[model samples]
Target chain A: MLNAIFSGDTPRSRPLTAILLVILVCLALGPFLFDGTRAFSTLGMICVFIVVVASYDLMLGYTHIVSFAHTMFFGIGAYGMAIATDAMGNNFTAILVGLAGAIALSVVLSLLLGLLSLRVKAIFFALVTLAVAFAFLSLATQLYNITGGEDGLRVRVPRELGPAFRPFDGELRGFSIVTFLSGLFTEPGNLGEVLRESVFKVRFSGRELMYYVAFVVSLLVFLFLLRMVNSPFGRVLQAIRENEFRAQALGYRTVFYRTAAVIVSAVLATLAGVMFALINRYVNPENTLDFQLMVFILLMCVIGGMGTLYGSVVGVALFLLAQNYLQDLLRLFAAQVPEGGVMAELVAPDRWLLWFGVLFVLSVYFFPTGIVGQLRIWSQRRKPAA
Target chain B: MSALEKTLDNKSARRERPWKALGKGPRARFAAFREEKPHLFLLALMMLVPLFMINPTTWAVLTISGLAMGAMVFLMASGMTLTFGLMNVLNLAHGAFISLGAFAGATVLTVWLNGYSGDSSLLVNLVAILPALGFALAVAGLVGLLFERLVIKPVYGDHLKQILVTVGGSIILLELIQVIWGPNEIPVPRPDALRGAFIVSDAIPLIGGIALEKYRLIAVLLGLAVYGLMTWVIDRTRVGVLIRAGVEDREMVEVHGYRIRLLFLGVFVAGSALAGLGGAMWAMYREIITAHMGDELMISVIVVIILGGLGSIKGCFYGAILVGLINLYVGFLEPRLAAVATVGLMVGVLMWRPQGLIPVIKV
Candidate 1:
């Protein structure tokens, strides 16, 4: 059924297919490539965000709905999982139950918001959703008994999923690839052990396990959304987006389609939230249900190119990569500057937000179509010229 | 005659009998009267809550404080409504202007308070307060002009782009403010003369023991004065006519050989100045100014605008008051659910009247 939905997209989506496949392969083997806690964790986060932002694109890009409540749904999923794990043990059943509960809540909430969408105009709809999301954030903070207030809720993973494995050890075992990799950088004898006891002491641990989990979930979500967007249903949504009145006049019940789109998008975002909770082993209002998170997702979609699933993928990947690396790059730059120098402030990690904000504004104005859209345009132009 | 000359002529002519010149005054007043009857009833309903829930004196205090809070919010929200109505720009960065104003006021007060001899005279305090307000308003207005040109001008009609770009602009502005003023909250105290409350019990018999803050009473008066000024300029003047006409049809106004954009820029600057003034007042009200104060309060401002029909100043005032009342009532009733109550009120209001309490019928 999924194949049938996506069959028509094959010819035109060759490049996207290639890009997504490459990402999947990289994510699958990400632990081996980077082989550390930071690498696996960052990769896991990027995977979850890929699903999160792509799901947002379903509403914003394809359906032409600008709902700010997506992050609220995301938070609900994380908090639901966190609460469930707190109530029940960190078993598979609890995770499943939590996910089901979160999806159900999101569906109900999105449907209510959809009804609101039916009542208000586009701008008004955005405000209403923003208001609702803010209320939810406030509730999360205030409901200390359930949500843990500002301190947030932490969960213990199941023993198997927990950080039990050590990738780099002091043992001289030459059989493992981790040992072999560590051998390449360090000296021949006790130097390797010393390095292993010191800098190389960093372990991939359960992060690799979490990475695979996030990877698998992200892959499933991306595939499902891809199929959904290429289906006849997605075409109807696109039609509604392009011209809602005309689509309504042409016998498409726009309200139903729009509501359906929001429902699907909200569910997908909830899934991403659940996966993110697993990776972080925690849930907080700031991390999940923030207006800033919604803006971040919007930035990803726009910077990637809205109306394209692959664009969202590229966007999430690029943005998370920049967010993770840019601070490091700035810190590196900061080290070169003399202490007490005024220029040192220029490269501080805290100043990255200022620069990123400038980049975001400039991108919106200059590259409104985003990276993927721009690439597609260039390609089209080249073909015509040829 | 040139359009400016005609407008001047029209202004002088209307000045002769300002009250009678706008023939719709009485009918508009009647419409407003009919519209506000529900709100008055709502206010009465709120008043009955104090009798049921708490003591009369505490209720009186809460009511006074809430109204004061509403007045400050109205001052902040009015500029937003004007810009949205005239420019078709959803300026998410309006909060930045508010913050800048607060910061400017704080900077002035910090300097003035440091030199003060701790005198309790109202005149001495006013000398310090006037310059602070002027500095804040001027700074905010100038910044608003730059923001319009650099950030807002590029994305005129598109709401999505407008929201994103303005949000980005606001973030940059917020960061810049933090860089300048440091991230810590700057304390902003009220003037010595305006610090305490007046015991209503001594003045009035039935309302005895009801203490209202001297500053709050002043805030209410200030809010009313601003509202009065806005109405006069918007409804009773030739510029008001031109603005209304421009809102109705920008091209038509432009065809009259007038630079509507310049007029709009003036409105934007004025709006920013109002936001700054509100920020300064709010800083005094809160007794501290954070970089995020304006952004934090912006949510309330947006809620007010939406509650009062969008782009309608009168509507925004009513909405602000309603929000302030709901906030106080809920805070007193259930502290945990206080935030939820205002949003709930908004949802309920929107559900009842989708266009808000007073839908401005766009001409």
Candidate 2:
């Protein structure tokens, strides 16, 4: 049953498995567990980005294809959602239409990209994709009448997905572990107080409902990726990555498989984009199609550990945690220092991307295998030398 | 030789001495030149776009500005191609250096050289700005050296790691630039001499009725000068010869007792300095500087290099000009479609020449 759920591939390390479980539970209980708007947004972003980053791993890690145009498909998906909803009204049908359109576009575009891209070497693929990404952005920006230009579009999610659309009459009562954890050390004997008095009122509303939607879809997609990777098709992809000429010599249509990989990955990424549009209720170039987002996705794939589906979970949780809480940490650190200097500016919240970027370089240098890889290594070492 | 053979095969050529045309040399030399640099004819063919597409005056002006833009791009791209050819390091953070130079030059021009920036004297403007450009170059080159050591040294032969680390470095450095310069766009101050267009009135004849910017002319000159110097050094100088030889066969050059590593380092630094210079020039051309400027230009720069063929200098030149002209021309003709068209042109070029305009080596 466990193997069936994991698609025959499991998180091999104890710590990794625990972390994955914790992330899954926390996200599954996010609205009930967390109160802050920023926390909710961050959670939603993490959920969406996990799928995006994981799909990218399918390309970069599994197939050794480095595409700077991952965000292009992402943008296309968001725009499709935004445009379709705008044209057809914010209903379930509109979403399905947008999603179907995005998928179709992604299929054709990724096929064209893969066909053109596989002809060139890896380096050329990166360069060409970068150019193509910019071209797409230009197209999006210029087609302002359709895409709303630089301002982007506010996607009117389905009425059921809207924040005000509560299913219940009032907020439903739930046990408040979040409150208990925060106050537990301060007041040890107040666990009952935290749970009783109906301390937390969890709304079975559309916003929380949207988070659950993102979570469930992400989980399903991640499992599907695991299944895909473990399949024979995946083995051929790995073989092609290892040695394309050898795979070709073995009579495998290498181009077909590589193109399939690109399409699968793109479809997943586009799905993530749809999730982004649904959750955020808005889609813009700056938000959906930023090149920096690609860097962040790359960071997730690298730090989580490449070629491991479970790594995306670890990566998304840690990076999102840092991105959200790092600012507070910096604020505390900066408070002790003098004002108006390079030190202050360096630690400014605006420069978080730099800190993460530095971490990316350091991780590439020092921890190329990443957290999951390292954990796997340590776990194997301890397990009777297995 | 093929042309010579064709002439020899003809009865007319058999009656006369075949060496007659060969002795005169200009026509044969032109043919040889055509054979050697087939893409130059492509460049010539593109140059003829203005004859039917647009008015002569507008065309001439656009061409000059386009060439100037190409010159700036060439400075940035030649460094990349040279480094790629010599060392096989892609250096995506080359854009970061450009950002560094722009900020450095912008600061210098607007602050330290403020007095001369507004001066009417052409010589004074040049004199004041030269130091700013130099300072920018120095700052960028020094950072490139550090970037190479910190981000690149570990991932010497791994293309994947090199690309990742370089990208990582680019983002970090761009952020660091913001940390220093603040996350805001800084307007570049142009000296009185460099400001405004030099209007060539119709009274001047065939080239009349065109307006050319003084800075653009200088940019074109500097670009041509750099191209000449690079070719000369590569063809003539010992270090250049060693670098070329290293590109062709590294072990052979090493066997001949030259430290290719030091030469590689030197080239890397020089390439970085060239990028810095280009950045400084670009800042002036746009009359604005921002942290993201280099990042924005990088898309076109990569396109230019790809079209030119990676790791080839002359190809970088023509590719830069072709991209610059295409962008400007199409932009002039049809607004908002330039970027897509540029990408389309890249795809078309790659299809025609999988390697590039100049075949450096197999990718």
Candidate 3:
């Protein structure tokens, strides 16, 4: 069942499998297992980013194409939803219209860009996409009347998906089976007391439903990417990446395959954007279209492992964990150091990106293959040769 | 040979005698050039945006400003293109050197030189400006050396890792810059001698005023000097030959007992120095320097380099000027056209020549 769900492309290494399980369980039980709006928001972002980073991996990892316009497609999906919903009221039909329109736009743009530059060198493609993305960003920023400029467009989901609407009249207290099972066997002071204060509360509100929406949609997309990657078409992509000249010699139309990869990746990235706009209820040049986000996505893909669909999952969870918590940890460290000193400045919570930058460089230098790839190597080494 | 064939050849040559005489003049030479170099023909076509439509004064101002902008852009793009040609290292952290140079120049101009920049005496103004430019070059070049060691060296020949590591390096440098310069936009006021414009043609018929800015003229001169120096080095120097040889075949150059590695290092540093020089000029041009200034300029540089043709300096130069002019002309012609002018130019060029305006010729 697990193998089928993972599309027969399991996380081969035992530890990788374990981490994937932990991520899946936590993300699946996010509403019931996490507290505060901050935690839920992080969880929701991780889900959306899983799809986003996976789509990037499809191109960068599978096809070895380094494109920088992934975020532009993301922004398109977001702005599409924002403009349509803003003008036509926040309804389900408007949201669907936005998704369809955004996908259509992404298909055309990505197709044109791919056919034009995919024939060039990788560095050329990367640079051209960067220029295009920068133009798109400025375009989004300049059209303030529609995109709200720097203030961003506020995304309002349909009534059923909105936070104000509840599915039930009353809230349901969350329960953790791990604690209940341990309490039952250990002769706890009160048998049911362990269930009452489970450290997390669950409510049958539209907010929790929104989390589920993001979670379910992301899972479905992730599985689809995995299935696609393991298929014969995906094998051809890998063959081309490994040696494009040889692949061409073997009769594959290399440019056509590359263009198809770009389009599929872009469409998926747009869907991720649709998920983000729905979950966050916001779209802006800063949030949806920043080059910084492009770098971060690349970091996550590399750290987790490129060419592995599950790598994005591991990467998104790991990187976001660092992003969300590393700053607070630094704040505590800054307190330990003297004020106005070099150490304090370096340890400033705002400078967490500096640390991540260091880590990214070190990871590139040391592993180059990423965490999952490294684990697989270790496991293969330990296995006896035939 | 048959007597009829000889007579036919003689008749054909006699028929073209007047046109051959016409071809001996500069106009025919130009026509020959247009036939030989189609990219230049298109470039000329782009530049021939009508002057009769707009006031000649606005046209002059716009053209001069466009040339100045193109020169600064040429400085940055040539460095990038040369480095790529030499070693295949496309350092995304190139903007870091630019930002670092801007900050360094700004520091000298604003903080170190103090009030001397406001002096009317050109020599006194030079005292402040020269040091700023020199210091920017020195600091950014040295930092680029360290960055190459730390970030670029480990990931040679790997474009993917190069992008990631250089970006990481860029992040670290930008943060360090913020740490030193304090995350605020610092103002770099120009020297008093270079503050205003020079009205060169106020009395010309139909053209009321041809006021050219003192600073933009200086920029044009600097760009020309840089281009001349590069052409001299690449054409007339032994090191230039070695660089060209290295680009064609690294192993063969190494086989000749020359340390191609040293050549690579020298080229990277020189490229960084050029970027630093451009950054210093850019700081003064805008009069305000921010940490993200280089990042912002990088987009334009990318567009310039793409249109110029990757790894080709001459192509980059042409691309820069074309983009610069298009920016000004379109902005003045139609505001909406101005919005997509650069992109439109790039797309049009790509459609015509995907390799770029000037495809690299093996020298």
* The candidate that achieves the highest DockQ relative to the unseen native structure: 2
**Cα RMSD over interface residues, candidate 1:** 2.0
- The candidates score, on chain A by TM-score, as follows 0.85, 0.95, 0.94
Q: What share of the true interface contacts does each candidate keep?
A: 0.66, 0.81, 0.60
Q: RMSD, each candidate, Å?
A: 7.4, 4.8, 5.2
Candidate 2 residue-wise lDDT, B195-313, digit = tens? 77888887887679677888999999999999999999988998888888877777798888898778888888888888899999999888988898898888888998888886778
What does candidate 3's lDDT look like per residue over B40-98, in tens digits? 88667776654766677787788888889889988877888877777788888888888
Would you list the clashing residue pairs of candidate 1?
B201-B208, B201-B209
Residue B167, candidate 2: Cα error in Å is: 1.1
- Candidates in order have lDDT scores of 0.81, 0.85, 0.84
Reference-based lDDT, residue A77, model 1:
88
lDDT: worst 10-residue window of model 3 chain A: A195-204
Rank ordering of all candidates by DockQ, starting from the highest: 2, 1, 3
Candidates ranked by TM-score, best first? 2, 3, 1
Candidate 3 lDDT for residue B205: 67
The weakest ten consecutive residues by lDDT in model 1 chain B span: B30-39
Among these predictions, the greatest lDDT belongs to: 2
